[model samples]
Target: MVAESGNGVHLLYPVDLLNDEANRDLIKGVLGTVAERFDDDDTKLDQSVFNAARITKLYGVVANKGDHIPLAPWRLSRIINAPERNAVVTIEQLRALVPVAPAKLPAAKRRGNYPAFDLLDFLTRLGIGYRQDMHEGRERFKLDHCPFNADHGCGEAAIFQKAGGELGFKCQHASCVDYRWQDVRELLDGPRESRAGRATANGNRPGEQNAATGTAGALRVTYRRVSDVQAQPIRWLWQGRIARGKVSMIAGNPGLGKSQLTASMAAIVSTGGLWPVDRTRCTQGNVIFLSAEDDAADTIRPRLEAVGADLNRVFVLDAVVESYTADGAEVRRAFNLKNDLAKLETLLIEVGDAALIVIDPVTAYLGDCDSHKNAEIRALIAPLSELAARHGVAVVCVSHLNKAGGSDALMRVQGSLAFVAASRAAFLVAKDPAGDGTRRLFVPMKNNIGNDQTGLAFAIESAEVPSAAGHIETSRIKWGAESVTVTADEAMTSQGDPEERSALKDAKQFLIELLKNGALSSKVIRADANGAAHSWRTIERARVALNIQVNRAGFGKGGIWTWRLPHTPPNTAIESIERHTNCAAAYEKSGGLCEEKPKRNEPDWEEF
Candidate 1:
């Protein structure tokens, strides 16, 4: 396209050059590669400047002058979008696109500058130097003069435009590594109006209400058609036991090793221990705990060390400052989960990549909220659940069971039903009905993410830990050999009172006294119990319940199975068993009653 003034000075510009992304950049190269000369005044065009056909066709929006065509922001897309290819100028309609706030002389500048501002030019104008080079297949500038460390002139600072046309800045220099992209914007283009009503660099208009949130612009919430929603794979913190980015509840009676088991898991996360059924290694990260119940030094830390956790990665969040004293000192109080969640969020940010968080007995930190109230419980847990999701951390909320024994383990959780309802998964730590009281089992009570998995067994072992005072005794978790094939409901079934467990224990002693001298076949043992006027099936149960081994030793026609005590001496066993033989209450107290003997023709009775 060519244009001539009434005085016959002609200007020529290639149409293709106007649409190039680097139109400003090529101008320098174009001037260096081509020569320019003034034309004679005697030269004449076929028509006058105002009557030129191409001027009318490509004028875009003629704001105030004909030489300067104000490219309409609305029709700039004609380079590709508009089919007619008509670039007719609309008068002054594109003035908003070329804001003249910085145009001191009011349109003295030509079309050489395109971007509202150039970062490189801004830096150079500020006496900062730069070097242009190719980066990631795109042109970028590396600072020859670091604004933060001008004396060192660190070469790590770089500037480039992002895919969406936003300018980005990054500095690998240690001193300026923390500088944000927006900080660079403030330095290049004068500091932006940092009020709510100001347009954000990301394109949000000042004080505009977000459509999705229906509130002040806080964050951008994007949506997609329901059919376009992609499904995310379920992530597990402990295989199927707990889920990541979700709140999991652990409920149990006190002293059931709930804290110890959780500490053991935290230790595993800190150390990158065996994770899956194959025991493959996973990445290690930090474990944070807000244990309101246990003493940090003696209980939490010792247990962590006992479980082989990286001590450095184990953090205990005790409390944050609640108020400032009159003397200008701080009055600190325990961190309350309901009120001080923002403080917890700050703590999570400080300890980034946290893998797990433990709020021992979440009710303890409920502050003034009533744990038993469903609404209040929901309110207390909502922020925490969101925090867990935002940080991709598994938040384990420890809880004790309601005193009501023998109810649904989920309902037994000491709080409103929301305690279990709000959690994605809930677990129960109970005395192993099959093992001694020292052994505990982790049973999945509720799992909304997947099928309820088989339970795992663990026991508490006494470990001596070094403390400021001296060595102290604390318990650490000892996982069982394999996961148990028991449901939480099944496990809780035998979770009877202490009296019942004691009765069964006493019956075992009675069985030992009855069989201490020699091994007896099942048939003969039942015969002896029947003859002695004791519950034969109950004695048989006791015989099988203890550590006694059952074997078949007789050969040929005399072959028979016998139950025998392995380590118990006949003399000592006889003396001990005497105390329990006459007590029928042992069966009654232990809730261990014998079923009637089966008929010979029917199926044989199963050994206890």
Candidate 2:
């Protein structure tokens, strides 16, 4: 197919034609000019007189005598990889078949008697100074400490090679005006004259007639061996919870304090606080939090203060407007994980030395993209993950749970499974079944990095912090407990069949012991119940089964509620009443010694 104008498109030639020397040599000069002519216009492609094989192949037959093969993009690459031998495949020969057809390709630098064992032997033998530097956003081997600049400190002398056996050099240094291409040729003792630009290393000059492809701007790729890659240690923001240079996910149901947990994490990161599991402290650094739901001043800032976070190091990404209308109204609003990632990356650079980033409810940022599609979701997070790895920062994306009451907690996390799959570590926050009302737990749903995974317990409590505008109520998390063995299943595991797990049995035993003393307030009971390793739900179940009586006294906000066993009377209370009655009876028997009976509402209650 001919590429349309304004698309900046260019076609790639087949590997077989590209590797052929005769075709490569003949097409070198005319590729750029000819490709530009036939790229968009069909005046060239109108003329086509093909052989019987070409005609039959269109219908997907074998074309031995009469068979056609299906034409497709995927199959094209495979076809080029395994081409039939003994075929006329030059530009002029192809022009005879389709005189007006468009074309495309590649070309590479020449090396004499090219052998697999020693490709860069010439450069190595001469001890030419070169270094790997970034060009067009990729690493390329280029001349370093220019041969001409070595004595004069000219930084811009560059050496390059072309496909037609030519060595070129140009001093980019503004002051060094005497340097030319011949100077390098005279030094390296290479070809006197040739074309410029590195070709596709495999030896092709752009294209050869109809040896064409639909892939645009085709350039060869270079690779480095595994030994050449730099090694780095896995860093953890919270040991076994969040890791740096990797995407980590924390998911939970709404109102389960997932955001609060994230804020607490940010607090720790900003202040260099100790982690719960190992007490390992992280170096203090700025935290970039992108929150779409909470108010920065009211909800987020207060929550941070409650957690004792350093306010200076915490930054809330308020709004990211992609474009605006004539009236200056925002068009694309806020940080979109799919589209505004580049903007977020820019923000990362602005806040240099950033250690952590929190994207609360990451699904909110995937504007207009289908979250359920695995490919789309993966594509969205992959770049952000790469950004994290590039900056050596821990990226935590918060997500909500699906209401699908499934047995697997991780699967219940809403949207594509890739959200969890792509994360290096995945965590879940939920009200702990075995914890007090103030208790919440961080469960390791998935740990792809290592096996030191363990569940952490924390408590969410309201703290009254004094502010300029009076005391403010804020929520904070406290993590000072031992690691628990409960898996993520604790969040989704149903007690519907209390018989399945001993959690109910444990709750019953704990409650029986706790209530054995007498009636206790439900609040205290619930807290102690959780502290005793009994889920509050199970405790409520046991309370129902045991037929415990719940009583209320007084009224309004000042009213108090209490729990008491139906069969057990207050024995201590009964004994005290009996002793008072006996004393009153003895006083009456003593006549004058008997105290005057006071009104029923009298404050004193003694019998003389």
Q: Best candidate per lDDT, number?
A: 1
Stretches > 4 Å off in candidate 2? 1-225, 323-332, 494-608
Q: Using alpha carbons, what is the TM-score of model 2?
A: 0.47
Local accuracy of candidate 2 as per-residue lDDT tens digits, 1-608: 22322212223243234534344334433443454356452343211111122231232222232112121112211121323444444566544443343432223434332212222554575465666454322223466555533423333555544322233455655423434445443334322222222345444433322234543333345588999999977887776567889999998877878888888888889999887777889778899999989989778989988888999998888877767899998876666787678888898898887999998888878876656555556667778889999998999889988754334676677776668877888888877776664677788889888553578888777888777898889888777468877778755564124453477677766776665545555655776876787777667767775687787634674444566655555662233234334444555588736454322222221210
* lDDT score, candidate 2, position 575: 37
Model 1: per-residue Cα lDDT over 1-608, one tens digit each: 33323222334432333533343333322332232222223442321122112343343332222112122112221122224444544323333333334223222222222224455567667676777776533357777755534433547677765322335567775444445445555443432332124444445653566666676543333457988888888777666666779999898889889898888888888998975343645468898998888898767888887878898998999778878978999888878877799998898899887989998978878877755445556667777899889888999999987654443566567756667877999998988877766788888899898668677787788898777888878888777777787778667646756665565566777676655554445655676667765575456557656767776644664455566676645443343233223222244556865333212222121322
lDDT of 2 at 49: 16
Candidate 2 accuracy as lDDT:
0.62
Root-mean-square deviation of every model: 30.2, 27.7
